[model samples]
Target: MPTLQIREAIREAMREEMVRDDKVFLMGEEVGHYQGAYKCSQGLLEQFGEKRVVDTPITETGFAGVGIGAAMCGLRPIIEFMTFNFSAVAFDQILNNAAKIHHMTGGQFSVPIVFRGPNAAAHMLGSTHSQAFDSFYAHIPGLKVVSVATPYDAKGLLKSAIRDPNPVIFFESELMYSVRGEVPEEEYLIPIGEADIKRPGDDVTLLCWGQSVPTALAAAELAQEHSDLSAEVIDLRTLRPLDTEAIIASVKKTNRVVIAEHGWPYGGVGAELVDRIQRLAFDWLDAPVARVCYDDIPFAYAENLEHLSIPQPEDVHAALRQVAYRD
Candidate 1:
């Protein structure tokens, strides 16, 4: 095993896939000449050349539509939006054409494309640039949403997403690009829609994904230190085809749960999880499911205010304590 930053893992996944498949190509703003906005595609331009690694104008819709069209014509295109908030500019193409093409054509066509980029709030980046669309994109019928937390999961899941013959919405966190973790050198693929129990415990289950996975883990450790409350942490690696079995099993074992994410509370992803857990494991639960999510407001630009806006480790700890009846 080798340690790799999230960005490096992502680049390796794309690089390996491009080498494995001739039809695979990357197209986005600043990807070719600038080596990617966050360096996720660094060294790709020189290795693959300008044709495979393209730089488009700032227009998200144009490039997204281009990717969708290319996919329909039998190419695997990885389209990157600077941030998913900017992806709103290309929502119609993503939701309408790419998502519907396979079903609308009676399986005559498949959109083997990956729309990937950093998502959610980054330090001091205003409301427009720092929104998470996990819930929104997961609502689509044909798109598969993959939100990654660790370098290992990033490489494995991205590799899986690229091979699948469907439109995959790969959401990464801007705040996690530098986070390092162990990744194996040999080829691997983590199946889509699987939940990983990062830590097993008996008192409570801390359900989370993406950037919040680390937050939940920290909260679990803090809960153990402060009150001897053992918290099991489940990372829902993929959102749309959520691993309901893993969630129910964890909830049944722990008897309490706290959901956390960097998204708004109203109709958030946590809300859906709460609904499923209550319905499937209602009798097993000892307490109502607690959630740690953003206060339903636009993201703030100030550093302190921004920090206060999204879910934090403290929030998770508090929620875990309440749910575990250790408050």
Candidate 2:
């Protein structure tokens, strides 16, 4: 095993997949000559050259449409949005073509393409650039949504997403790019629908993925240190197939749950999970499910206000205590 940052792990995954299959190519703004907007594609241009490592104009709709068309023609393309918030520009292509072609053609064609890049807010990027779109893509029927929290998961799950026979929405966070964790040097894959129990406890369940995963883990530590409470943390790595079984099992053990997310509370991922949890594990719950999330208002441009609006350790801790009846 080797320790690598989330960005390094992602670069390795793309590089390996490109080497393994010539049909696999990368095209996005600043990905080629400039390495990448975030430098996640560094050295790829020098190794794979301009043909495989391509640079495109700052046009999400055009490039994304091109990627979908390329996939329909049997080429695997990795389409990177500078930030997933930009994906709003290409929502038509993704929501209509990439998600419908397989079924529209009666399984005759599949979009084996991966749409990836940083998601959610970073620093004081303002409301427009700070939005998290996981719930948007995950809501679609034909897309596979993956949000990885660890470097190991980033590498393994990315490999699987690249090879998946469906359009995959791969969400990363700029904040997590530099976070390092142990990843195996050997090639391996994690199944698309599996959830990993990042931390185990019997007092309550903290459900989360992607940018909110670290918050869940940190909240668990706070629960222990301050309240003498234990919290089970489950990372729902893939949102579409959503490992509800894992969530239910943890809910049964803990009899309480707190759903954390980087998005707003209304119609967010947390809301969806709460619906499922209530439908499946309602009888097991000791307290009503609670959510720790961003305030419903638009993200603020000021750093201090944005910090308060976004869910933090104390917010999750409060949710934990609320669910556990320790508040």
Candidate 3:
């Protein structure tokens, strides 16, 4: 095993996939010459050439449509939006066209495409770029949504998404790109729709994904110092076709749960998890499922306010305490 930054793991996955499959090509704004807005695609143009690593105009809608069309014509296109906030501009192509084509055609056609970029609030980036939209995409029926937290999962899941026969939305948190983790040198693919129980516990279950996974783990570490409470943490690698079995099982064992996410409480991914758990494992639960999410208000540009808006370790700790104790 070797330690790799999240960004480096992503770059390696793309490079390995491109080398393994000729149909796998990358196209997006600044992907070629700019080496990706976040430099995740650095040196790809020189290795893959300009045709395979395309640099498109600033229009997200136009290039997204182009990527969809390319996929239909038998190419695996990885489209990178500079930021996921720009994905709204291309929503029609993603939601209607790419998501529907396979089912609409009755499995006659498949869209083997990946739309990836940094998602959620990062530092002082304003309200426009701060909102996390994994919930929005997860709402759609046809797209497979994934938000990866660790370098190992990031590399494995990205490779899996690229090879899957349907369109996938891969969200990487901007803040996690520099974080380092151990990644094996040999190739590996983590299957979609699987949940990883990062830490097993007996007192409460913390269901989370992406960046929030780390936050929950940190909170669990702090909680252990003062109390005998054990928090089971589940990292949902895939959002759609969510690993409900794993979540329900964890809830049944722990008898309490707290769902953590970076999005707002209403209509957020955490809400759906809580709903499913209530439906499937309500009798097993000892307390009402709790949620730790961002404040409903828009993300503030001020650093302190921004930190306040999103769920932090302390917030998760508080939610766990509330859920694990009864009156």
Candidate 4:
């Protein structure tokens, strides 16, 4: 295995899929001559030529619709939004057309399209650019939602997403693009809708995804060191079609759980997870399921206020402690 950055892992997945299938093409703002908004597609323009690695105008809705149409016509299109916050402009395309096309056409057409790009907050990029939409897209009926954290998962899950014959919302984090992890030199794929237990423990289960995976791991470490608490951290890599079995097994083992994510507390992804936990795993739980999510408010431009709005490792740690009755 070779260590690679999340950006490199993403670029490799696209490049490999493009070579394996000529129908697979990447088109988005800043993808061609600009390499990628986060340099995730560096060198793709020269390797695949301007046609496959295309640069579009600053029109998200226009490009998204074009991608959906292309997918319906037997092409595998990967549409990148500079930031997922801008995906709002193209939500109508994704929600009404891309997602519903297959069922609307009665299996006559399948949208083999991937909508991907940086998601969640990145440093002090301001309020408008910081909020995450993981919950919104995951709520859709006809979409497979994936939010990747590790370099390995970023590569493997992305390859799987590209090959799937349905609409996929692939989420990458601007804040996680530079994080490095071991990725195999040989190609591999991690099946979507599976949860990975990053670390095993007995006291509590820390369920999380995307940016919050690292936070959960950190909190698990802190709990072990400071409170002598053994905490399991499970990464719910795919939000939709969630790995409920994995979650239930962990909850049964630990008897306590704390869900974490970058989304707001109100109708957050964590809320749905809470519902599932109580409905399915309630008998095994020792304590009520708790969550660590951002405040139910828009992200603020000020650094300190933004920090307050976003969930952090300390927040997760406290949630774990609260669940474990260690506080």
Candidate 3 residue runs with Cα over 4 Å from true position: none
lDDT of 1 by residue, 186-284 (tens): 999999999999999999989999989999999889899987989999999999899999999988899999999889899999999999998999999
How many clashes (backbone N, Cα, C below 3 Å) per candidate?
Answer: 0, 0, 0, 0
What TM-score would every model get versus the actual structure? 0.99, 0.99, 0.98, 0.99
TM-score for candidate 4, residues paired by index:
0.99
lDDT (C-alpha) at residue 212 in model 4: 94
Q: lDDT by residue for model 2 over 93-124, one digit each (tens)? A: 99999999999999998899999999998889
- Residue 17 of model 3, lDDT score: 99
* Candidate 3 residue-wise lDDT at 91: 96
Lowest lDDT sum, 10 consecutive residues, model 3, at 220-229
Clashing pairs in 3: none
lDDT of 4 by residue, 1-327 (tens): 789999999999999999999999999999999899899999999999988998999999999999999999999999999999999999999999999999999999999999999898888887788888999999999999999999999999999999999899999999899999999999899999999989999999899899999988989888888888899999999998899999989898889999988888888898998899899988898999998888887777888998888888888889889988887
**Model 2, global lDDT:** 0.93
